[model samples]
Target: MLQLCRDASGAPLAPQGSVVCIGAFDGVHLGHRALLARARERAAALGARTAALSFEPIPREFFARGTPVPRIDDARGKIVQLAAAGADLLLLLRFDAALAAMSPEAFVEQVLVARLGAREVWIGADFRFGHARRGDPVLLRELGARLGFGVEVFPEFLVDGERVRSSGIRAHLAAGDFDAAARLLGRPFMIGGHVVRGQQLGRKLGYPTANFRLGRRTSPVDGIFAVRVHGIGPVPHAAVASLGVRPTVNGTEPLLEAHLFDFDGDLYGRRLDVEFVAKLRDEEKFSDLDAMVRQIDLDAAQARSLLGVPEARPAGACA
Candidate 1:
């Protein structure tokens, strides 16, 4: 099992010593994975465990206040990816006012030294932490010298000579270039969550869907997508997904509604991962229910063709 801690101060987690990697790690993109892999290598060399330190609500999100900064992944997604990336222990700090005010020295002493007993700490070239973003590699080295830890800087990760960055991935997603985004992510961009009950309007429209609410998350992609729904069966199910506020219905919150072709099993509470394959169209307001349904028919047909789904199940079969 992967051990997780949220508080900044607590009993020592790795008394035997650990190699720690720290970052916001919003997307766990290719660059972030490189840093984690370096930590694993260092941990193995020193006979220590691997630990990853990150922040929830990511510092930028906390500082952004009411402004929603687009994120490639959410908290649950982060946890899942971090573990898969070889983090034996996860320190997901709550980034509140108290933590924001902590000094770089204090963070190293309390979190890295006292809590994790870190023998070596790995960080990306542009990493920053502590109050006012004062923490840097130089400051970290100074603290490490006095705190009995060593600091290593992971080189900037690149693919095809292009640097991998969260911002670049976001830009690709915004532009609906999913292929470019996936190159940086090292996998197809996806969103996973438990199905939630919506207004059931899709069912009334002859398209039953499994809904996932975005809550406070600001997603980079918003539109009709050709997607593959995972966790439904042995193979992914080809589907058409809508991610946005339903303008026609006057809905406000961002919701992901996936209508799986030929699927009729109950999915109200099942966890599903919707993998975006291609953007079909942007969300638009229609004049009435009839018009909206017509547009939806077109969108679904386009998605089915793009995903190479031989043919959609019988009409109203999913309903």
Candidate 2:
């Protein structure tokens, strides 16, 4: 069973000692999978369980702008992906002021030695931690030697002769290169969240949508797109969606408004995973609702063609 631990002060993740890895793990991309594999391998060799220690609110999110942090994956997706990659436990520590205030020694003593009982810690070549980002792999290794555990710094990951970076993937997504983004991720870039009620503006404009909000979280792209919606029932569904603040509607927050083709029934509060297929256009404001409606009609048509699915226009669409 995989454990999801939120409080760092809780019982030690693995009392028998653990092999552990830590990172932002924003995308759990190909590179992150490699890191996790190494942790799992070391765990197996030592006959110990594995733990993945990551921060909630991601350090970037906490320190950067409040909205649209340009993230590749959300929290729940990271946890699920990490577990599937063989982590026995996930420590999603809250990144609050106290955590940010802790010195390098304190972080290792409290979280690594106390909370996780880590027999060995593994991280990438550029990993850093502690208050004011003062700790690096060198510091960790030195501390580990004196503290009785060991530290290993893995080489930077490479894909196609280039290093894989979450920022690079975000840049690809922002540029509307879904293929390039997916190449870095080892899978299509997607966001997963439970459906939340929206203003129903899409419905009034002839497209009913199931909405998800990034909510002070970061998103890499903002535009109309062709997409696939998974975790709806069983099979994935082709869809047209807009991911951004609804400018034409005078919206302010980042929201994902997905219009699943030919579907009906309540989706509110149900988990929806949206896979980006292709970008249609940038988000822009229309002078009037009628103009916005016409553009949406075109967007829906383009999406249907891109997805190779016939238009499933909801009943009562404007002529």
Candidate 3:
């Protein structure tokens, strides 16, 4: 069982001591996985539990204020990925004003030492934290020495001689290069959420869709896509998805709507994962409802072709 905890001040979670890995872990990308692996390895050797410490809202997002910060993975995805990475406990601290105001020494003392009872702490080589982002590995090691814990900085995780970065992955997704994004992510780029009820506009347009809200400041990927819908059955279903604010509908919030091909059933409240296979086109505004539906027909046809699904034949037509 993995424990999800917030708040820097709390009853010590690991009285037996723990190996702690700290980062924003926004995407839980390949680089973040390496750090988690190291933490788990060290914890096993020391007979301590593995704890992953990250922040909710991410520090950058919290500081961005009115500006929307693109996220590679949403909040739920981050927690799910972290737990699946073998963390015994997850500390998702709230990145509020109080947490941001804490000094480096105080953070180490309160969160790492007093709260988690960290025996060994791990972080990425360039990781920084605390007030004004002044804390570095050097400062952490010095604090560890006085606080009776060991500190180790994992070497920069790289791919093909270049460092892996969340920002880089975001760029790939933004440009609709899912192959490049997945190469660094170690898995297909996906967004998962419980299906939510929408305005039923798609159904009225002759394509009912399962809608998933992108519950973040902004989504890294947008536009129409050739995709697969997973977690509904034994095999993933081919689908066409749209991600963006519905400009034609006068909407202002980002939403992901996936219409599974040749399928019909209720998906409300069921969690599903939409995996991007290819970028079909960018979202566009149409002159009228009929025009919008016309483009959707094209999008669905293109998506089906990309996904290797045969197009639906006219009723009673030759095979």
Candidate 3 C-alpha lDDT tens digits along 1-319: 8899988898999998999999888789899898888889889999999999999889988898868898888878888899888898999999999999999999999999999999999887778989998999999999999999999878878887767889999999999999989988889999988999999999999999999987754888899999999999999999999999888988888899999999989899999999999999999888888999999999999998999999887789996
TM-score of each: 0.96, 0.92, 0.96
Query: Which candidate model has the greater lDDT, 2 or 3?
Result: 3
**Which digits, one per residue and each the tens of the lDDT, describe model 1 over residues 70-148?**
9999998999899999999999999999999999888899999999999999988888988888999999999999889
Q: Candidate 2, residues 1-319: lDDT per residue as tens digits?
A: 7888888686777888899899999888888899889888888898888999999889877887464376787787888889888888888999988898989999998899989898999988878899989999899989999988999887878888878988888889999999998988999989888899988877888799999988655788889999999997778899999998788878888899999888878999998789999999999999999999999999999999999997555579865
Best by TM-score: 3
Sequence-dependent TM-score of model 2: 0.92
Best by lDDT: 1
Residue 147 of model 2, lDDT score: 86
C-alpha RMSD of candidate 1: 2.4
In candidate 1, clashing pairs total 0
RMSD in Å for model 3: 1.3
Query: How far does residue 88 in candidate 1 sit from its true spot (Å)?
Result: 0.4
Q: How well does candidate 1 score on lDDT at residue 176? A: 92
